[model samples]
Structure formats: C-alpha cells, structure tokens
Target: MSNTTNFKNLAPKGLRIIEQTDSLYHYARVISNTRFGYQPVSVAYCKDASHVQYCVKFCSQNNKAFRIRSGGHQHEGMCSGNGVIIIDLSEMNKIEYIDNQPNQAWIPVGKQLDSVYTELEKEKQIIPGGGCQSVNVGGLTQGGGWGYSIRKFGMTCDSILAAEIVLANGTIEIVSEENQPELFWALKGGGGGNFGVVTRFKFQLSALTDYVTTFGLTWKHPEDVKEVIRVWMNLHASTEVELDPALSSSCTMILANPDEKDLDCDGIRELEEGQKSFVDGRMGGQFYGTKTDLIKLLKKCFGEDLIPEDSKFTLLKEVCYASKKKSLAKSEKETHASLARHQSILANFLNPTSTPEQEIRATNECKHRNYRVLPVAPTSTCDQPHPHKVSSSFPKKYTCDDNSEMTERIYDFLSKCCYYGDVSKYMSFHCLGGAVKKNVDKRVFAFSDKPYLLQIQGWWDDISNAFDNQSRNDEYVKWVKDFRLNIAPFTEGSFINFVDQSLVDHPETHEGLLELLEIYYGENNLSRLRKIKAEQDPNELFKFKMSIPPLIE
Candidate 1:
C-alpha cells in the first residue's frame, strides 16, 4: 500500500469502524491480534463481500496497510498489521448448502470450527477440519486443514469447490477450478490473504457415520515407546505404505523433564530432580469400520501372530528360528516379539495394579469411543501459549529397523526438551497416506507426498509474566530450534502450518525471505505463486510475514 495515506473523512456508512484510542480498541485489537504483535490503526467490521471490496479499494486508494481476519489463528499472525486497516469479517460468519448438493456448501471466512461442527451435526454431515474448535475456516483451509477424518476424506483445502474473493482492484469474483483456475489452485494450500480477501469459500463436504468408533493405545515406558515408534515409522508412517483407508491415526508422545522442580509447576506431582521423565505415547483414532476390521489392521503393528519376538521374550513354540546365522525368520521373530513386549508395557502403564486390565488392553487395543475428537479453542493472541514454536517435519521416506534404532533417535530428541519436567513439549507423528495423496498434486500441495508429519511442539507455560520473562521465552525457543536441527537427518522438511520464523525469514537471506519461501512451497509452486502475486496483487495489498512477495516490491 502507498505510504502517503489519509484517513480523514474516510469513515463510510453501514461500516462499524473502531479507530485507535476508541473505547473498543482493546476488543478490536484482541480480535485482530496474532497473540504475537499487533496494534492496528482501526478495525472495520465487514458485513459481507461488498464491505470487503470496499476495504480493498479504500486501503489501495489511501496507500495504507490492510489485512483480513477471520479466526485470527495464524501461526505467525499473517492476518495482522501494525498500523493498518483490518477487514474484520466476524459479522459474516454464515453457512449455506447448495440445493440437492449435500456434498457442497458455501461458508464464510469468519465462521469458527466448532460452529461448523455443531451446525453440521444437525444435518448428519461433516467437513474435515483441524482439532481446534475456534479456528476460522479461512486459515485452516488455506493452510491445508487436517482433522480426525483427514485420511478418510482429505485436507480441508481439498474439500473447497470454490471461493468468493474481493480482488485488489475492488473487483468481487468467483474462483474455482473451472474459473480463474490458477488463483483457485493457489488458494488451496497456497497460503491465505495472498491472492485476495476470501469472504466466502465453497467447500465439498463428507457424510458422517453413526457412532464412529474411537480407539487409542498408549506407551508409558521409555524403551517401549522407542520400539513402538520404530514399528510405526516402518509400517504406518512409511512412504511406501498401504494402510487401511478406514483406519487413520497419529502416533504422538511426550517426554517430561526429570529435573523439573516442584516450584516450577503447579498441580503436578512432585518428583526428585534426578528422576527420569515419564514417557507417554498414544496412537489411534476413530475408525469408520467395524471393530473386527480395525483390529486386524492394528495387529499389523506387531507380527501377525501377536507374539513377542525379542530375544528376552522366549517363544514357547519355535522349532527352528531360521537356520543361517540369525536368518530372516529369526530377525522377524525377534522384531515381532519386541513390538508385543512394548505393547504390553504400554498397556501395563495404563493399568498399573490390575494385571487383568493390562492384559485386556494389550489384547483389545481399541478402547471405548475414540476420545472426543475436538479442536482446542484458538487464542486471539499471535504467539499462542499452548505451543509457542511448533515446527513440523513431513518425511516422504524413512528407515526403521527392528533393533529400535530409529525410534531411539526420536526418543533421544524428544526426551531432551519436554524432559526435566515440562509436559507441554511433544512430538506428534501423523499417518499421511489415504485420501490426502489422492487429491490435488502431492508435489505442490503441502504435506501431500510426505505421509508422516512430525510436530515438534514447545510450550510457553512458565506461568511468569511473558513480557518480563523474555529470557524464559528465549530458552524454550532455543530448545525447540536446537532439537529440530538435531533430528534434521530423520526429518524430511517442515510443514507450512507449523511456521518457523528462522526458516520462513532466515536472517541470511540477501534482501528478502526467498530461502524460506521456497522451503515452504517448493520452487516451482513458489514461482507460480510469485507470478500470481505479481499479476493479481500488483500493489502488494494482501501481505504479512511469510506471504508471497509481489514483483513490484
């Protein structure tokens, strides 16, 4: 936007505008704040697409900053501005379905996740979305939405059939695969607010089943977690993988810091400084099929026989365990045994004193209804408190050995930061095959080819004044980066949803964030995006940190 701007006499009728120093400044700022940094000059409540168009034209004519806000859950607050105009679409939170087109619907950017779910539940339909309930559809879809039904359906972007956008020239238009195909393609997993102000999105929906079966498995023992992870990476998380489409689960675990002192946390059971951090690993999700089929698929985690193969667990009936010096059969048996032993350990952790319960859990992996599949309510602030710095690694290839070598590396990396007593840090591994790989171009869409997404999350829950405790924040930031680098060998690349400042805008870039841009979106896609940015938003209107840079700039 041009710098020679003037807001005097700019207020328009039918627009609810809140200027700085207004009584509603705090509320307006919160709505637009990324929880990172924000101090917009004013926020204009847009009731519809026409208002959004007016905002674009108004800002363009005035040469002022302008960014759009729906849910305001951007990792780096890409929708925020310092002293700019914010097109708040909160009033436009509306949804409508196409007649006889149960699979297609039109939703606005301001609608929250939970609202969509609650409304869809009434119709016995569902839209694949993130876990957080308050995340707006705009940010989630643009960043490639993931949910409990991701494998069954696809990312949220894949569901988008069309979008209603207000371009930089104040021209409102519809973009779909058939019209403005390039811009439409860019909107899907191409990052939001780059092409235009997305007021409404036409999404494809999926029908929900009656009483989805939720399942889960946990591993508490350190050694068991290591082996369990290895088996996962080898089978489910593997790139050359063939998994049951009905079954999709994430293998996530966290290591607590053994050295965490009682004074450091509240409500947590106190432990000695030297005590090792407890390891907690869980995997499984709601299955769209019967219990029998789900069981068979889960059994693949261990040898088909559900027997322990480790040398420690003696196989009762094994005549010749492969003849040649530890033959293939022998190795396979040992690996199977290791997995069973790990499973047993995990089951026991869940039922410490009840041997019967532990045995049953190990025998029956699928528990009662998969824990309520829900999304965390998003915070208005930019640097979200739950996980301050979330860096994700999407690996299309991986190597896992029965010796538990691969999982050990993951454990070694995880147990360091989330260890010492911090329960906030975690490593999440998601199965990436199924529908995600089928729709859209895997090479272009983020995390399409990479079947396994690893989220290395760091929390800022020290309970101290964040503003005053800059050093503490820095500590966690450093730990997150250091740990990510250490596991870089095992990691394929980062996920765009879990943005990293260091990678997105690396300090070493000559004059721009060129390096991180290519890293986020591959070179070809990034180039195409740049050209779109040039042609569509020549004035560099819609932008923030990590957005596509226009050629004119």
Candidate 2:
C-alpha cells in the first residue's frame, strides 16, 4: 500500500499507476462496482498503446491476469478480479480526424459514446452507435453497436476502417481488412474485453443529417397490452422493410408504477400490505425522413383506415444524435408529476423543511435521462457506484398467434415486480432490422441479425433492506431469472452485451456459456474467432467472465 508500489515501479515511465489503497484506484478499476465486489491487484491508466503493451508484459512477468477497462459501463463488473491487473483505458480517450481522409477519424477505445458524439458533432459527421450515452466505444462496438441510425448505416463496427491493437506478446499491430485481415474481422463487432487492448480505432464516418423524425406512442388502456403486441408483430415487424430501411421501431411491455396518491410513506419504504401494480406497453422509433412521411408510414402499419383509439403518438423535436430522446411533452408532464409524488414520498420520512432540498438531491441523483438531449450528461463520477442487474434476449420472430397466451405471460412477468417501494422493474424491447439483415453476410460482429432485442431489468436502492440484508438484490436478480425462464420458450437467442452468467458455472470453459456463444457469434464465426484467439493469445492471458477463450484447454 506504499506510494511507490511494485505495480507502479514496473510501469513504463509516464504511465499512471495507483495502489489498491488509493481512492482513485477504486474509480479507475470498476464501473459496475456492485456489492458482490471485484478486487484487483492494482489499476494502471494507459496513456497510449506503449503503456498497454508494457502493462501486459508486466502482468505476464509477475504471473498475473489482466483485464481491460474502457467506459466501465461493463456489465457484470468483469473488469475486476481477485489477482488481476486492470489496464485502465479511461485516460487514453482522444478523437482525432484523419486530415488526409476527411471522412475518416481515429477514435480511442476509452472514449464514451456521448463524448464521441459531442466531439464528432463539430465535424458534422455521424457514427451509428449507442444512445445510452455512458457506454464507451470499445465495449459497445465490440458487441455490435446498435442505435437509431443502425437501420440506415449498419452496426458501429461496420463503420470501422482500421484499428491499432497491442497483443499478449506486447506487439502492436495495425489491423485492417488489407493488413491483418483476420484480426480486423475479429475486432469488428466482436464482444468487448476480448482479443487485445484496442488502443485506437480508425472509423469511416457518415455525413450527419439535419433532423430525424422520431416518435413515441403508448397504449392508453393497460389491458390492451396483449392485443397491441400482437398487432405489432402482425403488422409492423413482419414487413417493416417494405417501407424503407431507414424506418425502425422498438416496442416494450412494462409494469406500470403505482398511483402517486397510493405511493404513501409505507409504499415508498415498506410497501402497503397488499397493493398491486398494473402492466402497460410502449412502441416508438425514428425515421431518416420528415415527420409527415413518418406519420404516413405509421398510419400504414397501424391501419390507415382506422387508427387504434387506445394509441397515442408524438413527433419529437430532437435531431438524429438525440433521436432516442423521443419522450414527448407528455413525458415531461409525467416527470413533474413524478417529482410531486417523490416530494410526498419524501415528506413521510424527512422533515417538512428539508424535504425540498432532499427531493432535489434525489432527483439529480436519479440521473433522469428520459428527456435528455445531445451530449447526454453522464452521472458525476464517484468511487462508490450503485448496484443493478439487467439481462436480455433476442426473439428473432414472434410466431405466437395466440394473443391471450402472450398477454398471460406478460402479466406473469410483471407479477413478480417490486412489491414494495419506488424501486423500479420493467422490460424494454428494441427493434432490429434494416441494414442488419443486409450486413449479416459481412460476418464481422458477434450480435446476430434479429428482429427484436428484449431487456429484462430491475433496479433498487442498495444491496438490501434491514430485515434480509441481501433480499433486495436477490429479488431484483430473481425477477430477471424467472422472467428469462418464462420467455425462454419464445426467445431464440441472447444479446452478448447483456452479459448474464447465472447459468455458466465456469465462463472460461463451461459448455453452457458456449451454448450462449453460438447464439451470440454463430457457430462458424465463433470457430474463426477462437482460432484467432488461439494464435494471438495462446496462454489465454486476457481471460475474464465473458472474454473469448483460446481454442483448447
């Protein structure tokens, strides 16, 4: 725990190394620093590719495993381990335009997507990537970056022109289709934290558009969830491509929050003895055209003759970069209503005079993101990160003609929702198609071409409550677990980015995780990726919960 530790002493000059006892070490090491815990030997921040090369060599010489860290929105906290050395890449973020090729740019793996977007905005170019602003370029593109423009442009990896990777042997290679064709193929849309430390990415940028027509529609009647999902599958998903590749949609069925009047003190902390939550659904997306054409197309899908009375739609004012902020003015109204509810909920436990300040603090702390625009402000950095769990699946095509069965399943899924307070639980479905299908033959990324990706999420205050210390965490995870099982019969595969390892006894070698691997990278592509791993990292030095393993034991 000394200032001049061996980890620091061994580091190449100019590299930043922090000991385990340092406050910065905690923030530098983990993003999803959950209550379960991940302890690393030391955290080293690499300024450039040379630093990464030295760190890998240093780890090998010291008989230690090393994990990569980028935006650290890394699901499962896989960046940390008992005796691992963390190659922290947050400091390496830099976006530089390739002057020779005006349409091309070099982006560091460590830069968050929002920061990348903010930087690229000046250039008036775009990269079809993530909307969840905090995710980094390395982790997201590694797992097939999908976003509003994906249908128009293809996955994030598809836009890459080249990359600079530092391998296990500390050799830095400039990889691309022409140079290291095999390595280039593997890096494009391959899962994150695998292969090697990708220090820099050379991307082919697309011209930015002025305004993207985005829309949000919700079903008024909660009981209509079943019929609406059926109509979506029957009308929208089946033939979206007939309209235009630029148009896409994502529909989700979620548990509705309790009425604010009912969310009294007992409901916020300890739930009322027996209050029930309702189920609702939302469907929304964007198009590469004007609002008029978007609405005309929506009418075609919903039935031009007669739009459903229960449905409501709105066109957002935000452009392509902020396209995901499709929340209408109504959502803003809902936010004010929610704040009022929170104020009342806080009044129960806090002094009346201090409630306003506490409520404001709670609102800011929540990181309210639904109405956020471009340069989506990220939560303030902190050493003490909160804990949460999420899992996802891909149902390639919905064949369930029985609306009642789907409705019953939806009810059953929401039935296990938080029985207590303001803690939230819901399901999110994102639409997939367009260039995804056209680009499938490219064989570059891990994520498959699927019609829909479903996110099963649960969030709570902390690790637990007073009665059962781990109950809250257990409950949140179990909800996703049970929901996964219930929907297993319907879903064909799982999204790699979701990173659920509850079934894999040994992610390093287990067949169960491998089964999910086939779903992610496909058997043939996976074989190719494994072969590359075998040759590049024969000893499997860069192994973690979900990192690609070498060909053999």
Candidate 3:
C-alpha cells in the first residue's frame, strides 16, 4: 500500500494507478449495484489506450486476470470483484469530430451519456442513445445502446462506423467492415468487455431535428386499469408511424400519509388525494413489478389474432405478479360514475354488481396492471459506404437502425426477466424503422427486410420477505437465461445494452457472436478471429469472463 511499493514499480510510466485500502468500495460500486464477487487485486486508471496497452502487456507478462471499466454502471458490477487488475477506462473522456461534413466524430469510450448529449448539442449533432443520463457510451453502445431515438434512428451500435481496439495480446487494431469486418460486427450488439478494450470509436453523426416533442399521461382508479391498457394497445396498433410514445404503468397500495390522504368520510376528494399519496409512497418503496414490451403485451392483452405472426417476433413480454395487495381506492364521484356505466360496456365482462362500492370491490378483486411505452430515437451512421468488406455474417452498410433494434429487443427481454411482479409498464423510442429488414449480405443483424423499432424501460422495488431474497435472485438469473436460450430461433439477435450477465452460461444467447463470425470470416470466421487473436498477441494477455474463443491451437 506504499507509494514506493514494488507494485508501483510495475505501473506504466504515464498511467495513474490508485492502489489503496480506501479504493475497494470505490471500485466495487463502479456502476453496478448487484452483489459482489472476489474483489480486484488493485485498480488501475488508464488515461488512454496506450495506458490500456501497457496494462494488458503488464498483466500478460505477470500472468493476471483483468477487468475493463468504463462507466461503473455495469448492471451486475462485473467490472469489480473478479480478483483481477481493474483497468478503469472512466478517465479516457475525449470527443472530437474526425470529419464534419460527413457528420462523423471520434469519441473516447469513457464518456458518460449526459456529457455526450451536452457535447452533441454544442456540435449540432446527436447520436440517439440510451436516455439514462448516467450510462456510459462505452458500456451502452457495446451492450446494444437503446433510447428515445432508436425507433426513429436505430441503435447506437448501428451508428458505429469503426473502432480502435486493443486485443487480448495488446495489439492495437482498427476494426471496421473493410479492415476486420468480423470483429466489427461482433462488437456491435455483442456486449463489451468480452472482446477487448475499445480505445476510441468513430461514430456516424446526424443532424438534430429542430422539432422535438415530449408528452406525459396518467390513469387513476383500479376499474380503469384494464380499460387503459386496452385503449393504449389499440392506439399503438394503428399508431401513425411518425408518432412514438414511451409507455409505463404501475398498481399502488394506499399509504398512511395524512397530508396526502384526507378523511374519506367527506367524499371523493379525500379518496383521490389518498390515491395520489399511495402512488408517491409506492415510488418511495421498492416496486414489486414487471416491465414488458408494448408490442408483445398488445398481442397478449388484446389477442394475437390481430397482429401478423411474422411480426410477433418483434413483440416482447415482461410479466410480474405482486405479493403485495393492489389498491382500488377511488373518489366517491369516480366510483359512482364507473358504477353507473359498468352495466353498459364492461359490466357484462364482470359479475353484475348493483352499487358503486360493490363494483369497486369486484374490480379490485380482479387482476389489474399498469404500463408505460416510449419510442426510441434514430441512430447516427457513417456517410458513404465501406464496400471492400467481404464477410457473410457482417452488414455491408452501417446505420442507426441496427443499434436501435438490438437495444429495444434487450429492453424487452430484461424487463421480463429482472422486474416482473409488483407493477408493469411499457416504453418505446421514436427510431428509424423502414430499413430494419434490408438484407445486407449475410452479415450480422440480417433478421428481416425492413427497418426496426426500439424501446427502453426502467422499473423495480424490493419486497421484504416477499420471496426468499436468494430465491428471487436465482429465479431472476434463470428467467434471463431461459429467454436468451429461446431468443435465437425467433430473431437474428437481441439488444446489447440489455445483455444479461449470464451470457457465459448460455453462449447461444449471443446469436450475434456466431453470426458475426459467419459474415466476417465466412464459414471459417471464428477460426479466423482466433488466428488473428494469435497473430496479434500470440499470448492471451487480456481476458473477460466471456469472450470470443482463442484460436484452436
């Protein structure tokens, strides 16, 4: 722990290595809040790719496992506690336009989402990305970045024109379809930290439209829950392709805040206030719930009979049944109105009840859920084309749509697996769509012939003694694995940002990996990548928990 320690003697000349007793927690919580594993041997902060190369060489020479760090927001906190050397990429923040007319920019992998947005605004360019302000572009794009722009633009990966990567053996290489198409496809929607350390990315930038609109709508009362969902689904089915709405929903339990709740004896006003209070408290507490794909649930709730089967694969589901009681409290006036009309439309669907109170009681007893839906923004892509690229599994042309679809798909899968139980909602991004299915050779993401839509989501709350904590975690992991297992048969790939931590357990979950190989190396892509891995750094100097296989020696 000393400044003059031998450990310091091995450090890179210009790199910054912070090794101290106080650094554990700082490194431990980088971006992931999940449970931890064995802590790192130490943390090393690299100023640039040169430093990263130095760390990789050092680790290789000394024989050590190393974890890459960019934004600490890694879902499972995999960057820490692996008993490896932590090469923190959070310090490498640089954004510069490599070409302006073509709208291309070179961004360091360490930049955060907020910083990127702020900077892009200044540059009069925007790369549609995951809206969560805290997410790092490195982790998000590598993990299949999705956000408000996906539906309108496509995914962040779609915008990736090229990248500078330092492979496991400490060899620096520029990865693009023309240079190393296989590696390029894998990195797009393939999940990061697995392939190698991404020093800088050359992204295709797009002009930001002057007209941007945002909207918010809320529904109250338990009786209206099902109706609201039904209406929302119906609306989305015929929704104008130009209008994208991010959707979300939840059920609540009444809270005891007197200020929020009034004495109910006076009437509906008190009841309405009480309902608001309950919602606020619910947000304050752990939400026991689920977030599902609007497209999928639209089919589930309204029946798949309406949507074409070919399009069903585009639908996603995330379900959650809460152990806590769902509230049905409503103002007397609202209840009275619903009861009056109950017999006319939905009345036949339920047990015929005479009074408003009876109707509320019946509706409460029935299943009720809430939802939210939003459209993804469009992606930024390189201008012109890189034609020399000759891989079957790779896409010849890069665009924002590629990244949008992948991220939205992952959002659907993750919402189903991680947050299913207390409440449910849906969201979508206004992204580029018409070009999703374009068959661009046999390259990666060749699932369809049209542009794709993207969505984003967030929801969850803890429940004490709800389900055994250990059991819940185990169940969550299993659920994610099961989905990954089933995903390949239906679609070409999934969203990278929503990449599950259990990718190691089910390699098939990453259909993009093999597909990229097929496109880049043709029939022998994996073999070629392995051979390149060997030629570049003969010794496997860098590593991640899961990665492309080394050449079969």
TM-score of 1: 0.77
- TM-score, candidate 2, is 0.79
- Could you give candidate 3's per-residue lDDT for residues 344-414 as a string of tens digits? 11111111111111011111223322222211110100110100000001112223343334333433343
Q: Assess every candidate by TM-score.
A: 0.77, 0.79, 0.56
Of 1 and 3, the candidate ahead on lDDT is 1
Q: After TM-score superposition, what is the CA distance of residue 193 in candidate 2 from its true location, in Å?
A: 2.4
lDDT of 3 at 348: 16
lDDT (tens digit, per residue) of candidate 2 on 126-176: 688765555678877877776667778877888888889998888998988
**Residue 343, model 2: Cα distance from true site in angstroms:** 28
Model 1, span 374-440: residue lDDT tens: 2222211122333256677765356555225546666665543323222155677776678887866
> Which residue runs of candidate 1 sit more than 4 Å off their true CA positions?
1-14, 31-35, 237-241, 257-276, 291-296, 300-387, 402-406, 418-423, 462-468, 504-512, 551-553
User: After aligning candidate 2 to the native by TM-score, how far in Å is the CA of 531 from where it should be?
Assistant: 1.0
